[model samples]
Each structure stands twice: as C-alpha cells, then as structure tokens.
Target: MDHTPLRIAIIGGGVSGLSLAYYLQKFGSEAARQIEITLFERKSSLGGNAETVWVDLGNRRLPGKPGTPYRRWADLGVNDVNLATSPHLRTLLAEIGELERLKPLENTASYFSRDGSVALTDDRELFRGASDPSHELSLADGGRLAVLIALLHRSAIDLVESRRITPRYTVDDFFDACAAAPAEMLSAAANALNVDIDWEDPALPERLERLRHTVYYPRISAMYFTDDRGPGGMPLQAPFEYYRLQEGGSPPDRRYFEHGVQHWLEALAAHITGPLKQGPRVEILRGIEVEARLSTQGVTLTERAPGERRWEADLLIMATHAEDALPLLTFGDGLSETQRELQHILGKVRYTRSFGVCHTSATRLPPNPNLWRTRNIEIRGREDTFHPYRIDYVVNRHQNDAETPCYDRAGLPQFFVSLVDDLNRIPRSEMLDRHASPPDAPASLAGAALGAAGYRDRLPAIESALEAKAWTLFKHNVLDAECLEAQAEIERYNQRTARRRYEGHRGVCPLLFAGGWTRGAGLQEQCLKQSAHLVALLLAAPERRLNPLRLAASGGQARQRHSQASGFAPLPASL
Candidate 1:
C-alpha cells in the first residue's frame, strides 16, 4: 500500500481555513495519517476576525477571588453565534471539547434615533417609524404599520411567484414590484443588512440573493417565506409572528463563547495540531504572508518573511479574503481561460474598511440604561447623517457569570464594543493604544510590532488597559451583488471542472477557494459550510460525486454521532 501523504497548504487562519484542516483530519481516517497539512496566516494570531481583547479592571476583584488579577475578555469581532442555525459551528465546538462552554445570552436590540426620542422596540413601532419624539426620525419615518406590512406580504408573494427571475433581481426590484415599500424602509433595511450603499438609488440596488443569503432581512422582507412550500410548490406566507423574531432569530438558545471567539478558534486549532491529534502532521506558520504559484507539478508557496522561505504542496486552499486571495493567484493573459475566468469572478468580490472600539463607554449606549438590550443600534446626530451599521454590543450582557468585577462601586463598569462604519465617529479618548486608525489616516503598524505573538502580545498592561481601552480595525468584506453573481458562476465552473476531473481531465488549476466570500454572506456558518463541502470534494473517491446538501447535513451530525457513539471512532467508508 502506498503510504505517501497528501500535502495540503491552507492560507488564511480564519474560520474557513481552520475548519477545513479540522474536517480533513476528522474524516480522512487512516488516510489522514498519510496527510500532511501546512496552515499559513498573515497575522501573527491564528483567528482572523475572531479576535478578543482582555481588559483590566484595576483593584477590582471577581466576587471572591482577590488574589487573581482582575481582568475580563471581550470579543472585538465575531461575538455572537446562533447555535440553532449553526450546526457546523456546534459540531466544531463539540469536537474541540468546548461545546459545554457555550454561554446562552438574550439577543435583543433596540433601534432608536440619536435624539433619544424614537425607540422602535417592536415591529409595530418599527413600521410606524417613530415612537414619541420632538424631532427624531425612526427608520426615516416611513410608511404606516399597516402599509409596510402589506408591502412586505406583497413582496414575499412576488419573490415566491417569480422564482425563475434572473439572479440579478435586486432589493430595488422587489420594492419596485411591490410598488408600495417606502424608500425610507429600504434605507433602513440596507443599513441593517450592511449594504452600505444608497439603497434607494435606481442605478445600484442590493441583490435579492445577497440579502436572502445574509439571512438578516427579517426587518426588510420575509425571504424565508420563499422557502416554506405550500401545497403546489408555492412559497407559504410566513407567519406574521416572524416580525417579533430578531434578526437571525433571537431564541433563548443563542450563545457566545465563555472566554471569547478567539479562545474557541484556539481550542479548535489545538485539536487539529496538538500531540494527541490523530492523522496528518499539521504545522501552523504565522506572521508570514505567502504567495502561491500553481503548475502541473504542484503548488509552490513563497513566504514574504526575511529569509523568503518556500514550501511545496499538492493542493492549495486560498481561504483568505477575496481581496487577499486575488493577488496571490497566477493571473493575466498568461493563464488558462478557466483560470482567467476564475480570477475575474474572484475579483468581483468587494470589501470595505470597518472599525470597532472596546471601551468602558456608557455614552455609546442609549441615554436610558433601561432601554439597553444585547445590541443597541443608535442613530447618531441626525437622520440625514445616519450610518448603516453603528451598533454597540453590551459585553456584560454576554457574560456567562452573573457578577463580574467592577472598578467603581458607584456604578457597574460597563464594557461596550461599538462598531461604526466611519472611524471618525469613535471618540479620540476611546480609541486607545492606537490599535486602530481611520482609513484615511496614515498607515500605522504599531500593533504589528507585537511580532509573532499577534494581537495577544499587543494586549495592554492591566494599568494601561484600564486607562486606555482596546480598539480593532478589520476589512469588512461582503458578498455584494456582483460577488453573488460571481459565486454562482464559480460554482458552475467548479461543478463542470470537478466532473471533468472525475473523468481524469485536469482542466482547471490545482487550486480551491474557501471562505465566506466564496459563498454568500461573510458569516462564520458560511465559512464552515463552504470549507466542509470543499473537503468532501477534495477527498472524494474517484466514483463519488459531491452533494453539497448531503455534505452539509452529514458533516456535522455524522461526525458528532461518530465522536459521541465511540471515542473518535473511524468515520463511515464514505463522507
């Protein structure tokens, strides 16, 4: 028997890349023992957007422990996970032995205007567009509740009936077909869904597919209604009660990491590369940016570090963001037609700069503490100047423990993470450690000075952390209209090429793309599912064909059952 191992190289240390490595090991069985994996990350840290910062509360102690340092951790990115909808993530947590660490939290939000008068707590109030305010405008004070609800019902009907319409159908098209959805409502929906565009503009409308994939459109539409079949294959009318459900469903079962998202990533990584891990030899290389070249021979990865190291692998997975992955691939007229097409499709994905600050700022929340929910969406200044994604997460509400240390006895020290589309909105005092800077601001790599330790090394000292909070800046990549179209094309291309490969035709490049960007919506679930599907394809037997639906359903539950039934028993003969 040939014991030669399959050499695999994965770029990007985010959920996509990590999950791919993990599944490969979990499913490869004894074949996994013959697989060698090299994971590369540009940042010194492993987790990409799953970053956490520890804050120090000077002189404050956790209830009884006075000797231990008083510190609490808060996620700077990827804070919440809807366990009900996230089977893949749930499986991962279980496999990595961290499933029990899931801390349930109430996922509620209060949307109000900057002047503190318009509090839209429920759908009726939201549709009304305002509560009681002197000059505040809620959701642009658009249509009455009855009118908006009618528009939604009509829009849902149109989407279901017109299922054959081009994927180019945009939110604008849906609104046009409905003819009664208020423009202000579109603006609000655009903001909530992170469209970041002038949604009302006839020239540029957010794609309906992108919005649907985002799955956060309950505020805007009953897209889920399009899924539930009624009698003769028509979409069932969604329950009117859906309006009460928060974006992505705010069930009592919603969970966040006990330590933070970074801890979860670390635990998964350890399970993948630790000594106890079975199968493949997994090596993680950090603080190294790699460029890839593909040929009939194999993949050659060249690092940007001082020595300019190089490595070889049979297959390369570009799990990095679309922006980061585009440049690494071989491009231009020199490439195959398929390669060129793939490059073009990948380049279509768009990204925008986003900023966030983790600070002890009560000012970022609603004026009335009573109005605070898990998430607070405040309209700063005025309606005309409203930012689409100015959300503040109350970290305290996410804590598993009922009581945590508070530095001051007068009032509990509240930790809030404010995500603003505009960096200028973050107060200067709150933007401590210079960890983040405005996009237009001259580039600062001060945080990068932490070397291989990454953000973990950049953590502020207890005293310093108490004085100046932690801030983070990351690329807010999105699968916009063009990106969604590109994804469809890419899927078609992959399917055709995979069929050809099954017939021993190596027509496409020896490369694969895995990331939330490759699919729809930059959510963790998208990343995990896409990566798992890619794994099934990469390791499938010659006669086997990829079934995304089957893989999605099986990967989580099958592996989970296998692990639980018998401790790390061999998987079934086939995935």
Candidate 2:
C-alpha cells in the first residue's frame, strides 16, 4: 500500500541483467512506475556477449561520395539463435515485436574445419571418443539422428520436471538416464513427438540415448561454449540440432537478427529506459566498478568511475558470474557464516579462455562453396591430441544467399570469414613475438594449421587478420562443476532452514541470481527463465510485491513464471 519508489541496483549488463531490469521497469501496472533501477556494467559498451563491430570488408564508396569510406558490420560475439527450442527467448522477441529482425538463413547441412580437412560433415574420425559402437558420429544418420535428438530433448525436459531439483541432475545424469530409461517411456516420448517407434526394436531407447550423449550434447555446446572441455564442461563434440523435426513446431530452424543480434539488446533497452534523446529513465552506468555494502536498508553500492561515491538501493540483483559479484560484497565478520558459505559456493564456477579472429582478407573457402556459400566449420580433434589452435568454426557472413532471401551485394564480399578459437591451450605467453606484430599475424597461423591438416585446396589470399573478439569464457555458468556444487549447497541450506528463497542470517539475502547458467537447462531460454523467476520472487515478496496479485494467479510458484513467459497459451493445469 505504501507507494514510495523502491530503488534497485543491477550488476552486469548481460542479457540476464538487462532482461531483469527491463521486466522490473515494465511490471505491467501502477507498480512499474514505483520502481527505480540503475544498471552498472564494467564493459565499455552494452550487449555483453552480443557484440557488433563495423569494419571494412573491402567494398568501394558510394558513387555520390567517391572519397567517403563505407563500412560493413560484423558480429564480434554471440550471433546464433535456435528458433525451434527457445520458447522463452521467443516470448521476449515477440514482446519486442521484431519478428522481422529474426530472419531464417539456409541452414548448413555440413560443418568442416579450415580447408575442409577434418570434415565433420561425415567424418567417422569425429566420433573417435564415443565408447559405444553404435553412437558413431557419421553425417549420414541425419534422418535417424533427427528423431532421436527430439526424444533426447524431451527426456531433458521431462527428467527435470520428474526428478527433484538437485545437483545430481547434471547433463551427464540426463544422458545416462535417457540411455537407461524403460522402453515404454522412450517409446512414448518418440511417438508423442511423431517420431515413429520401431515397435520390434526394444533397444531403440538405448540407441537414441547413446546418440544423444555422443552427438547431441556436444553439438549444442558448440553453439554456446567456446570449447567443451575441463571438469564441468560438456565433453568436446560437434554442434547438433534434432528438435526442429519434433512434431508440428517449426522445421530445423536457426535465425539471427537481420541487422545484428545487438539490435535486440538495443530494442530491449529502449523499451525499458526509453529513447536516447530523452535520456534513459532507467539510468544505466557503464564502465564502472562497484563495491557493495548489503544490509536491511537495501544495497549501498560504491561506484569507482569519474569519481568514487556511494549509491544505495532497496535490492541488488547479480546478473553476472558469481565470482565477479563476490568481491563487491562487504562481508562483516566472515561476511557472516551464511554469506561466506554462499560466496564460497559461488566462487567455484570454472572458466576457460577463448580466442577468435575476424578478417576481410581471407580469400579461399572450402571446396563446396557451391553447396554452402556461407558455411560454418566445427573442427574435430582426435581424443588423443589437443589442437592448440582456437579455430572452432569458420563462417562466411557476407555470402548467405540461402538463409536471407534478399540482401545487398557488397562487392566481392563473399569472403567475409568469422573464426573462433575456444581452446586457450596455446597461451599468449608462448606467442609474444607473433602478438607483437599486427593481430593478423597470429590469425594467419590458423590458416597454416588448416592447410597442414589437409582441409584446404590452397592458402587464403590474406593469411593474417584482426583478432576481433577474444575472452575468458567457460561452458555455460551454473551447469559447471563448482556452480553445481554451490547450487546443491544452497538448496540443502534452504531445505534445512525451511525457507523457499535465499535468506541468510539477517532477514533474506534479497540478492537473487539470474543468467543462462543460473537456472533450468542452460541457454538463452534459461537466461529468460531466470529473469522471469527472479521477477516472480520480487512480486511475491511482502516488502517488494514486485507486481500485482495476478502475476502468480496462474503458476503456483515463482519458478513457473518462466513457463508463463513462453506465451500465447496457458501451460497445463497440472504443470
């Protein structure tokens, strides 16, 4: 009933942080105005992983302005989206009403490494690690793999709902569970998804499950994780998609922003904060490091930028890696036992380094440019050998005639290559000399490696290129080993205290976690889900009452708010 505005602070300007801020400000009724939010991002620009850069791919200036320079845009960070699987993300896109921005491109049937040497498209060597005899990574099983993939997706969704929310439900857990499930369950999952079950073959479930582990998981990881390795990450494998064939949903479809994925972030920000001319009503502070002092009076954040000062808020939402957030907290007396323990658990999430290169000079593509004008290559490494190169995939951005119906022809632009390197095994310490030269120097090394592997016909015209984007990224957040342990610890602690939300020694923590890695099956969908889950928690709070009563009139708990966001229809009553 009290109408005093509630001030809140959000750390990290990533999708999780941005979406949380956006929804809190757009809480749909009178309460929306009563909330004031300030977002702080340490980065120089907004749109964390969705970064866009404008550079020349060697096109001439316009006729009118002969001397004027022209620049083409290239995505420096996360650019792919699966329209088939990410419902919650779709809801966000729908709310933004930018369906046109997400246009489909011709999906590549095969993936290869540089010069098409280690052709993952159909290479048996790709499945060198799979212990199972049947789960070979051949490209020909595409049709069967498609059906099995759908079942595996359903299994993850079903298992999460069926099993208790516990740390034991790792991706590995789901893999083995599906592989060992009762024939009836597997049969039904396949049949419901309209994938005809071979009634005579009782081993169908085991077959599908093996393929899921050997093929499906690794493929999905490629789309997100820089390199699927280390203790907590998915095993290194290729990117896979099969859910597209599931029942009546859209075909195997992946869509990217017609302009750039960055546009979505801009639009979301505009919707929440308003246009730039009027200034952001929802104040955003960039390139600022913040120190937090948390207590009942809300969060008092000290910003170190321009000048150092304190800004207080009623709540703090950490939408970044938990480790980045831990130092900011001013823990009094071991930060209190509960807070210390929380910090310890969060600190365990592991991360790895990733490197990439973007170049306008790459002249040659793989042999089948006729089949794939703009192909993406996922290099397959032998289980015994570690390829120190960061070459994850090579994408020709400018020549996507398959996916986009109508696009401008930027002269001789068919060679815009985007390359990724997740394995940071080759540290900068060893490559200082190459680094001293233009970034193109090290990038050229990638070409040589590909040619040596016997994938390319000839050397690229330009061997060197710009090291456009590189960062220390790991597999998705909470899914990793340390975070899972931490998550389990938090859940156990909550169970002992009989508290549903995060409440430490003094009242509740009032600090919620949101990100792709924080909740449910990790991905952009999880990012959206975590946002909705946090928003629902806020609404349910007696102090915050984030939104009106109708927020929970449908879903029984705050978690269901995620399902609620996957719009256009109500979830089943039982769900």
lDDT of 2 by residue, 82-191 (tens): 65555556667887776667865433423444454433332221212122223213322444554565555554454444545344435555556555664544565665
Off by over 4 Å in 1: 1-3, 30-33, 61-69, 122-166, 175-252, 331-334, 379-388, 400-411, 431-469, 497-502, 541-575
TM-score of 1: 0.70
Clashes in predicted model 1: 1
Model 1, 302-382: lDDT tens digits are 887688899988778888777778678663233477576776887776565455677766777778766665567653332
Pairs in clash, predicted candidate 1: 5-34
lDDT of each: 0.55, 0.47
The weakest ten consecutive residues by lDDT in model 2 span: 566-575
TM-score, per-candidate, Cα-based: 0.70, 0.67
Alpha-carbon deviation at 493 in model 1, angstroms: 3.3
- RMSD (Cα, Å) of model 1: 11.8
